[model samples]
Target: MIIEPLGGSYDRKAFSCGVLALDQYLHELANQDVKRRVRNCFVAADRDVDLIAGYYTLAASSVPITSLPEDLTRRLPRYPVLPAILIGRLAVDTRYQGQRVGSILIVDALRRCAQAAPASFALIVDAKDDKAAAFYCKYGFRPFQDRRLSLFLSVATALKLFG
Candidate 1:
């Protein structure tokens, strides 16, 4: 499978991660978001079958230092807000579960963000649930004190893994 930018001809209907909302986003809103320059959505598709295997979206964002835990705040710059790239959503088709597709998509997202200009300091993701939070935690993401489901990983750390 290969990851590529979402496009007109890709098969979005056949993609389902067992979540109606996520599936609906791909089928109904992904293209529109792309056209409006809202978020950049990337899809993983099987080269032979041409079916979407998984996908994720990324957008520029920021986090207030005041919202972070004291330990984290101590290490960051004195600036009130820190630049970041948000992983708006991530899901893998149920058919491709346990195949590491989600991990691949995440690595791809981090690599893209790391190489983007006007560099961001970290990658942030809002986990839909505890399970999703665990998945991200496995990749070294830490939750802010105010929000357990909201996690972050520094760009420096991500680049060390994927740069």
Candidate 2:
């Protein structure tokens, strides 16, 4: 499989992650969002076919320092907010669910965040459910105090893992 930016040629209708919202976003809004410069989306496609196997989106974001754990906050500058990259959406087509496509997409997202200009301090993900949160936790993401499904991984930690 090859990972590349979302393009007009991709067969979005053929992709389904078992979630209506996600599927709808890809089929309806993904290209428009990209055209508007709202978020950057990347898709994993089959080597020979114009089929999208999975995809993820990234955008600039911030987190309040006060919302972070004391241990994490104490080490950072006394700024009110910390810069971050939001993994806005991540989904694997049902046909590609067990093939590690999600894992590859996330790792690719983190690597891009780590290499982004202006430099991000962390990677944030708003997981859709408990199962989604658990998947992120396995990658060392920690839940924010305000929400169990909202999780983050420090860029320092991500660099160690993916740098």
Candidate of highest TM-score: 2
TM-score between candidate 2 and the true structure? 0.96
lDDT of 1 by residue, 57-113 (tens): 999999988877787778777999999999999999999999999999988988898
- Weakest ten-residue segment in model 2 by summed lDDT: 154-163
What Cα-based lDDT does every candidate model obtain?
A: 0.90, 0.91
Report the Cα lDDT for candidate 1: 0.90
Candidate 1 regions off by >4 Å? none
Residue 113 lDDT (model 2): 85
In the predicted model 1, the residue pairs found to clash are none
Backbone-clash count (model 2): 0
Clashes of 1: 0
Task: Provide C-alpha RMSD values for all models, in order.
Answer: 1.2, 1.0
